[model samples]
Target: MGRSWQGRGRGRDMEYDKGGDNIGGASLKKIETEKGVIARFVIGRSANKGDSMDKSIDAENSQTDDFIILDNVVEAPEEASKKVKLFFAYAADRWDAQFYAKANDNIYVNMDALGSTLAAHLGKPRAYIGCMKSGEVFSEPNQKWYEPEWWKFGDKKAYFRHAYGEMYVITNALARFVSINRRVGSKKMGFQERTPLMVAAMYGSFGVLTYIISTGRSDVNRVSSDEKVTAHHCAVSACFVSIVEVIKILLDASTL
Candidate 1:
């Protein structure tokens, strides 16, 4: 007699087969926010199964007409791209604002007095003040008075005082630039000489004034040196040279 299929538990076997089919049907889902689209793919346990599932999933999950995919990666739309660009642009602008704020603070701290002197002398309706750090004044004849005469015989206090005198001279030169230009009735002027004022103020010498004026840079019209005329000695002339170069560049760019 042949064994009955039912007696062999074929009904239980069918139930197990149905459960296995349910597991194979489980899928991984991908959703795109912008397009409001959903993609579903079957999950597989083996490499071959995974490969088959990938092909099936890709076919079922193809991008809609409004969306695009390149090399299995989503590409941003024009609007989204524009938004990203705007975000970076805003960030850069904010950074620049912060940088300028810090720079203005530094200018106020170190160069406020010098700036004020320049403004007063320039006599322009408006002026932008800038600062530079200078070293000891040059030893040239025009710069001798501003340069310390007795560097070899000073204590620390005397040395510091001498240095401060040089700083004052530099400030005076900046002031002189403004004053001479204003007197000439030129709002936009080129470089001018402040060496005479610097020399007379520091060394009580009027002869150096003629020498500085001979250089053909503008000189203050007043020839007499008295209480009203004062000069500040500069310790380091190199600093002025650099500042001049920077100003020239800025002026040229503004013209362009």
Candidate 2:
């Protein structure tokens, strides 16, 4: 008598034989018969499901063109491949949806895994900055509502957005990240002695502007070297309705 197999998962499907030939201690449930010999049979416990299922069951070719049963494993190529490629697909989809619609199909790397792996590959400071800029947020949940900084690779100080006159609203996640990560506050040597707070304000990243000021990383009245203009000046000059919230943050900070 062979041991009875109990499948795991909420609705896992498992096939077995009622009374097939016993091979060793396991029963041989022949999937196919060719030349009077059994074609395929299962031999081990099913693989546990995790982020990826470890293929534990073993089956042998019984003689079926439609399906290949290794030990007792019968898997459709599409189904099996999806399990293996789940994370990769998920990461790629997120990156695509958030950043570039045109290059979505071009990306093949697994961003979920890439977030961890790439961080390890980069220098300590750079790795941290890289993941943050890429919007990976390893420590925090990358939820839709938890918007991250719009910063990206090579835009270390968010200079490009300011230089090109682009504006954004920073999210709570980005605010927390910058507020907690002190190293990110280090100002870069640029044409304008614009602190991260100044850059955030200039680009109209209200959440970041508020956080930087509230965290005391920047003096609300701090001015740029070139123009001597403060965050308040920038918000007023932008004159966009979206900047209204940023203006409120700046005004409140100035009073403090």
lDDT of 1 by residue, 1-256 (tens): 1100000121221111112222112111111221111111111122344355445434433521111111211112212222222222222232211110001100111122223233333322122223333244444456644444545434331222211112222223333443344334221232221221111111111111100001111111212122221121121234445554554443334321
* TM-scores of the candidates in the order shown: 0.14, 0.16
Please give the lDDT score for candidate 1: 0.23
Q: Using alpha carbons, what is the TM-score of model 1?
A: 0.14
Model 2 segments beyond 4 Å from truth? 1-168, 185-238, 241-256
Clashing pairs in 1: 135-236, 136-235, 136-236, 137-235, 137-236, 169-232, 169-233, 201-231
lDDT per prediction? 0.23, 0.22
Candidate 1, 9: how far from true, in Å?
99
Candidate 1 ranges with C-alpha deviation above 4 Å: 1-129, 132-234
- Give the worst 10-residue stretch by lDDT in candidate 1: 207-216
lDDT of 2 by residue, 1-256 (tens): 2322111122343333333322212223231121111211211112442212223222211221111122222133223222112212222322211111000111121122222322232222111111011123222346553324434324342332121112222222333333344233222211111111111111111111100110111112222222333343345335444534453454234321
Error of 2 at 92 (Å): 30
